[model samples]
Target chain A: MKDHEAVIVGVADAPLINGKVAQPGSALQIVARCAKAALDEAGLTLGDVDGLFTAGMWGIPGVGQLPTVTLSEFLGIRPVVHDGTNIGGSAFEAHLGHAALAIEQGLCDVALIVYGSAQRSEMSRNLAGRPATLTMQFETPWGLPTPVGGYALAAMRHMHEYGTTREHLAEIAVAARAWAGLNPAATKRDPITVDDVLAAPTISKPLGLLDCCLVTDGGGAIVVTRASHAKAQGLKPIHVRGHGQAATHWTIAAMPDLARLTAAEMASERAFAMAGVTHDAIDLVEVYDSFTITTLLTLEALGFAERGGGGEFVSNGRIAPGGAFPLNTNGGGLSYAHPGMYGIFLLIEAVRQMRGEVEPERQIANVRTALVHGTGGTLSSGATCILSLD
Target chain B: MTKPHPVVDPGTAPYWAALKEKRLILKSCRACGQAHFYPREICPHCYSDDLDWIEAKGTGEIYSYTVAVRPAGQAFEADAPYTIAIVTLDEGPRMMTRIVAADADAVEIGKKVTVRFVEEDDLVLPFFALGGA
Candidate 1:
């Protein structure tokens, strides 16, 4: 292993509510538990952590402003490097790339990336219009739905131009539910069908209730260090092969194209190029599923399917469990849990799948390479990371 | 609950003030010869401060839209199932507004639309109706 190569030696999620360790607590408390577990898995302690990366919507005015400082103070470890980048849900995936560069540059030795949210527990998530301030003034005053409406616009455009149907979108939800059925931690695992998706109440036109991700209380963490250091610690090192991140626009109106995810295309191209691997070489895939359209557009953006070909590609159970392609094995945010920011959980599940730590039913056999991509905002930002068990 | 209204600031004060007189205006960048919505002091296209206001045709085609079957919030419960749309103006810039139609089916992509001003409290919000000019 290269001495300067960054490797992830530890990954963990906060106490699971439905799966295990159902400890009810604040967002901070949940992250503390998750961080402890990840560090313990790495055979390290807070004293050894010199770098900290964290992001969230939990403590906006006070804790969120200085998220890393709050976490460092609570964890009782002061490090030379710290980053608190909140680019919506993709912030954690972006953190993974930032942490890798920091580790490679010798900025810090032990890096910890963590996120926690209690939106569900606190009932903080509501179908409310964003305040008509700043860039949102043009949107909120029109009573445009916060997020679903933006995605619906994309879906409508995709359908109008590419002959995609609501049924095609339902296939993604059906596939996610099938995967969730095999996941013990999945929030909704009743095994829904395409009809169920179509029958669900429409939150916004073209996007039903089932089309949206679950709003659950959850937290996750990851520990990264040099590959050489990981070997010295007697832990298996999952190499950070490549990572890339990009943002197109904050508001949906400003998005360059309603039918395409330009940020994801840009982000994955850089990541795939840096990793020196093709899409066919990837053994497993995990992507942010904030909405069903999110997964579909990301699949196209990631090159799994041709542009305007995602609807046909995702049809016929291609990405379902026991299907041709393995995707969102942990049920994704759609069926698993989305506590506001879902990127951290994507990394956690990717690391687990690579380490073969997931339930046998959902585990992909012999995963040598995994690609995890996170989409944040209203299809406004994207971050991609490639992990290899080399 | 009252619906959300735009908070006018110095940079956007002129645009909002013009709306009171039912005049639709946009910030036209002299440097880049481009027009943009939600007025700004500097040109977004050229990053130049040499910007001026120009009256817009306020006619465009629906680039995309969503009918909010569910209200955005409590304030919009009465207005559920309203169509929110991005209309590409004839002047070549897109803006977010509501598309008011006699029937919901009248809203669709490529449908020609013209701007309509509605007085809400102290603000006049620009919405669109299904028609050209």
Candidate 2:
């Protein structure tokens, strides 16, 4: 097989809470558990794996063990490409691209992309204290603590620039909760109404309680397969029609347009080009919902709706089950789980949709082509992958 | 030491110190024509070593903003229901700061805002109140 033709034959996840994981940051315990689950789901053992990629932990202080090295020692598997990146959740997709490149280069056969964080767990060292690296050292000294504040700033700007309302943002949380009602695994499965979303507490002003995500302890993983090998091995093959990634801005202030993410647009364009399908061809979307605003922005950027119209589209129930473009079927970061690298969860849910394995009530019909988006670092990084089944 | 030590590192001491003086500053990259807040050692764009800190004009538009109803972390307990906004400075860069003087309904996008300092956690935070006020 030539380069860039690798497929994703197996996928799985640990879970998420408020777009965060439950591990105690770099526990190594969560990563191991999620990786094992993914390998098992793929019908492959640790010995069958030859590559690894992991990301999104302020957990480890300063350890140099990549998953391929550490897991080989822990799970006892060895491979050439060992990637441990921290670009927020989008790093997993970046890892998949690298794994695809490795397979295309004949560097490795099976690449395991893994991410887990105990973000919500106790004994978590980083949230209170600053990590060795943070995009906010200079800015936060003005007192920017966590990423919620960073995005809150953007949410405010979106409201000021467009006529985006608090009610509009509420629609996102309401819709996600509506979807989560059917998904037992989602953290907030109580079935919240828009009024409930509006009345809920506020995390940052303009972004309410429902606007923010849960920060829980969990992990997620995916197995990128070589298309040729999967066909011969009789594994369910999901074609990665196209892939696109862009990380041009270094800081939130550096963005050309903070109200909208240009990177999501660039990624979706490239992914659609590779998939050989237009937005009209996509039956379901699994966009990262780190916040309600993220979904609204990505939806507009992906052309699912017009800019500033995401709130209306979401309010109309277009993205809910039986809608034109069902999203984050596994309850998303709001209802299902966020566990940090939400991108991994997006991939996992998309694969399940394509495989026709999604629970009947939650499944979006005719899911031949799907859009999976991952965001990293407070919308600082982004990746888009288009997948389809033959 | 009390809680929230906020150990001022080598790269960010100046900006924090200036904020203590009720003065706002930003890092301008000579290599690329971009003004960036949250100063890093290198340019966020070009990664050039050529970077310098300059005082901001203290006037910017509320690019976007929101008020917090819930307190986050220990640092903001007293500041719940306070305004947090991203202000697009006159220099063409956006900076995050809290908003004061205006209630949520009074705040609008593209509204003019000005910088003021709020002392908390042994750090003087830059916040924006309604500009004309």
Candidate 3:
């Protein structure tokens, strides 16, 4: 069998509804819009897309099962290959590798991956009456604060074990906002200081409101095809140089180590090995920042910084604009839009940076390669992808 | 407002039932000698169905924790600023629980804790408090 490579030919995002408490649209509407825009960007129509990959419908209540099938029918396309890989926020990143392999094996040529969320509009009601899953049964009874509490627990442990301070976490929020200032589409653009982050009301201890991602309504899509097919279509190809995915545990309680993200270590190691590149060779990084602790842990786990040194590594304006490492140039989930699942946007931004299609002020000069990392399911799942224009 | 209660399913019914009697029990795999929390039908480590329920002394150390300054949902609104923690059991497994009968700020990692049962709407949920207290 020939070792075929898959390339990302097109990427697009639905119009971001920023700062609004609610977006007046259904999840399907947002997803369809983004899917159409992505297909148009690829200079292809729905008919050309032979595969459809999306997260499962179980994430949102009343969204029923077989979301990919529903989406395919709604878009009026009969796909030969379809998948609903539900790994939470990292599901879209997981799709990248799956679609690439499917294209490589000739199972499908064009794959469209997409995600959309109306979380902001659904937050109050969803939180009021969350369904009883295993996590809810075990942890909720004790008043565990759902998502924020779990990540905060990890943060507390990190701080206890390494003496990480709130100032260190605030630096992440401040840097992210600085990057957001350069992105006109970002939801929050106001410059903030470390003191401002610390002063923000606390949601969970050791993680204030500023440490969390913005709740907005948005969706993103990506189109992948064989490198030869992209060349035939005259599309600029962003080569998928390497990809890896792994999970450490299903729930926060089961995590082997609270202070470490072992899955991210394994995932990034496999990805870097496959791409034949080291951390220094990468031009830029796009890491998932569901919370400040997530980014800090990912950096340490991916070997970008020494364990327990992530706090120091991010200090001194190192990750902000005009810094050595241009991290989360799209403002990340912190200042950027986070519509529940944020992995797809990480890939979209990486492709944009690799193609040099972003704002001139934020674009990395002579950008040839980018690494995108995503965490899902309370940091239970991780996916890493390396992309290069070469 | 009504507080959140456990939705005891068949696999975990035994564990919750035992808790109702003020007993803390965890599943131990006979094949691998590993104990796990949030009762499951099969062992997570060895995937063996041969399991036994062992009474735990309920003494443990605080592995990690956070104080919720804001309520996660309406059910927890009255309990804002509560301390939620993962306690590493003496039996070699960890469980998601809360620390009560103490100030939230005073809850520290590595502090010894013991399981305490709290009655909530006819359900007895296990929580951890300072061991010596």
Q: Best TM-score goes to which candidate?
A: 1
- Number of the top lDDT candidate: 1
Query: How far off is residue B102 in model 1, in Å?
Result: 2.1
Clash counts for all predictions: 1, 30, 0
Off by over 4 Å in 3: A1-4, A17-24, A56-63, A121-130
Interface RMSD values for the candidates, listed in order?
0.9, 3.8, 2.0
- Model 1 lDDT at residue A204: 92
Please write out the lDDT profile of model 2 over residues A99-130, one tens digit for every residue. Answer: 77777777888888876666566535223324
Q: On residues A1-390, what C-alpha lDDT tens digit does candidate 1 reach at each position?
A: 798899999988875665333788888888899989999999999899999999888787776789899888888999899899878899988999999999999999999999888788788888787778888878888888878899999999899889888888999999998999998788889888889999999989899999999888898989999998888888878988889999998878899898899999999999999999998889999999999999999999999989999899899999998899879998988988888889998888888888888999999999999999999999999999999998
Relative to the unseen true structure, what is the C-alpha lDDT of residue A185 in candidate 1, on a scale of 0 to 100?
82
lDDT of 1: 0.89
In candidate 1, which residue ranges exceed 4 Å CA deviation? Answer: A18-21, B101-103
DockQ per model, Cα: 0.84, 0.39, 0.68
Per-residue lDDT for B1-133 in model 3, tens only?
7776667787788888898899999999999999988777899898999999989989999999988878767778887778888999999999988888564667889989988888878888888888643
Q: Which digits, one per residue and each the tens of the lDDT, describe model 1 over residues B40-123?
A: 778878899999999998899999988899988888898888888898999888898888756468788999999999887667
Q: List the residue pairs that clash in candidate 3.
A: none
